[model samples]
Target: MNAVATSSADVDAIAQVVAAVERAQQAKDAEGFLALFHPDALWTTAHGKVLIGLDAIAEFTRAVLPKDDWDGRVTYEVVHTQFLRPDVAAVKVRQVYHGPDGGSEGAPLYVMTKQDNGAWLLHANQNTPVQTD
Candidate 1:
């Protein structure tokens, strides 16, 4: 971790990126969601499928997101953020999907990087379903 202090501005920016993700997922807009990712991003789905790069992520998103069968909306909330560097952050998110049946939760960790233009983009992410006993 870089010794630099984490700023509220950076946290706010990261939160905005997360909010965009929620919006995209709720709207089933693959392109909108993909726009927030880095070219070499890695993503692991809640079900354990791993996507290696933007191309692979794009392919999967396009194929699966629109066809999702859940008749409800999903929400993503940023629960914590750790700054690894001035330009990189590891964010923990609480994800919930509410449908006619009930609600399912997920714990997603998103590693995001800030670009030269100061824009934060998702670099790597893993979504793990919350198992209830």
Candidate 2:
């Protein structure tokens, strides 16, 4: 996935990984979401809680995800991807929460690493709420 050698397939695969996150969120499937992360992945919540690893992330998400109700839908769009190396990338995402009452958004950064098996797994991620004036 290096910039020089990046192919459409690589970009598509990365987009799919990002889409999977949105799917898991919509379904409130904690396990499904966790499967996308590396064993030592770090995740920071939009509200600023920092989770150090898979275990901590799982614990937090299992409790919070199920309690979430968007009343409409949520979407995740891959806005950009910067390849740090052939096996690593920094992906920027635009996240939107849509509901009848209106919506909110977040800008998330997901740093993904290509696994030995060639799958892209989230290595580190941060969710920052998009504040509107």
Candidate 3:
């Protein structure tokens, strides 16, 4: 079995993982999105709060996609990375979601964790609303 990596490695792995997340979201591949996470992965949304376990995770993700305004595409950049431990890390990514109708929402901060399997997965995520006011 693979082991968790160092902090830097965790960051690198998560970078890719997050990218894959974007791709999966764009593709609306529910299974693909789920595949990036460990069986026991958890995600805490910015406003909706915590979604624990894979079933909830899948439900949340499915709800997001196929929305009347769902873009299914997200573009983002990693603004910061913090490591709480060798196997544990978090990333703040600046993200924007673009739906099929050309609407967009964003700058959400995404936090991720690298599991014992040496794969980085979404741990928690939140975003400040885009200032349009």
lDDT of each: 0.94, 0.90, 0.69
Residue-level error in angstroms, candidate 3, position 12? 2.0
RMSD of 3: 5.1
Native RMSD of candidate 2 (Å): 2.0
**Deviation from native of the Cα of residue 121 in model 1, angstroms:** 0.4
Give the per-residue lDDT of model 3 (tens digit) for 8-94.
566677788878877877887888888876656667664656778888888987787556555456786777776666756667777
lDDT per residue (tens digit) for residues 12-129 in model 2: 8999999999999888888999999999999999989999999999999899888745442799999999888878889999999987768889999999999898899999999999
Using Cα atoms with residue i matched to residue i, what is each candidate's TM-score against the true structure? 0.95, 0.93, 0.73
Clashing pairs in 1: none
Best by TM-score: 1
lDDT measured at residue 13 in model 3 versus the true structure, 0 to 100:
78
Backbone clashes under 3 angstroms, per model: 0, 0, 2
Count backbone overlaps in model 2.
0
Candidate 1 TM-score, C-alpha based: 0.95
Candidate 3 global lDDT: 0.69
Per-residue lDDT over 1-133 for candidate 1, one digit per residue giving the tens place of the 0 to 100 score: 3376878989999999999999999999999999999999999999999999999999999998888586539999999999988999999999999987788999999999999998999999999999998
Identify the leading candidate in terms of lDDT: 1
lDDT of 1: 0.94
